[model samples]
Target: EWAKAFNPFFAGENADWLAMIPFGILALILYYVGRELLLSGKKTRA
Candidate 1:
């Protein structure tokens, strides 16, 4: 019941890859930004 209410990928008869693309891009961008920030902090500390 909860799965049916919240799961977008499996909500309809087809999988929603289009809806998931922006989220994937955002995640990758966030990961790279976080990594760069962490590295810059370590360099400044050293």
Candidate 2:
């Protein structure tokens, strides 16, 4: 009963795409940060 109430994708309800926007942005930021760190490391080593 409590689980059903907290579940966002409950039956008959459409999934909320808006809720995922922040997560997508966070993923992009992490990707860029990781890329920069790797590049910096390689440059420093070489």
Candidate 3:
């Protein structure tokens, strides 16, 4: 990921918050995708 090299450029001094964006976005996408799959199953009415 270009984020690696770009990080030092933008991160500057405070690296903690700068590094969290990628990880936070990943977790959010995974959670939403999993939720969609879980709710995808439907029951048929007799």
Cα RMSD (angstroms) for every candidate in the order listed: 5.3, 4.9, 5.4
Tens-digit lDDT string for candidate 2 (1-46):
7645776654325446646777999888889888795345545544
Cα-based lDDT for every prediction: 0.72, 0.66, 0.73
lDDT for predicted candidate 1 compared with the true structure:
0.72
- Model 1, range 1-46, lDDT digits (tens) per residue? 7766777665765557857888999898888788795344545544
lDDT per residue as tens, model 3, 1-46: 6755676736567687767889999888888779875455786799
Q: Give the TM-score of candidate 3.
A: 0.49
Off by over 4 Å in 3: 1-13, 37-46
| Best candidate (score: lDDT) | 3
What's the TM for model 2? 0.47
Between candidates 1 and 2, which one is better according to TM-score? 2
**TM-score for all models, in order of appearance:** 0.46, 0.47, 0.49
Error of 1 at 6 (Å): 25
Off by over 4 Å in 1: 1-15, 37-46
Off by over 4 Å in 2: 1-15, 37-46
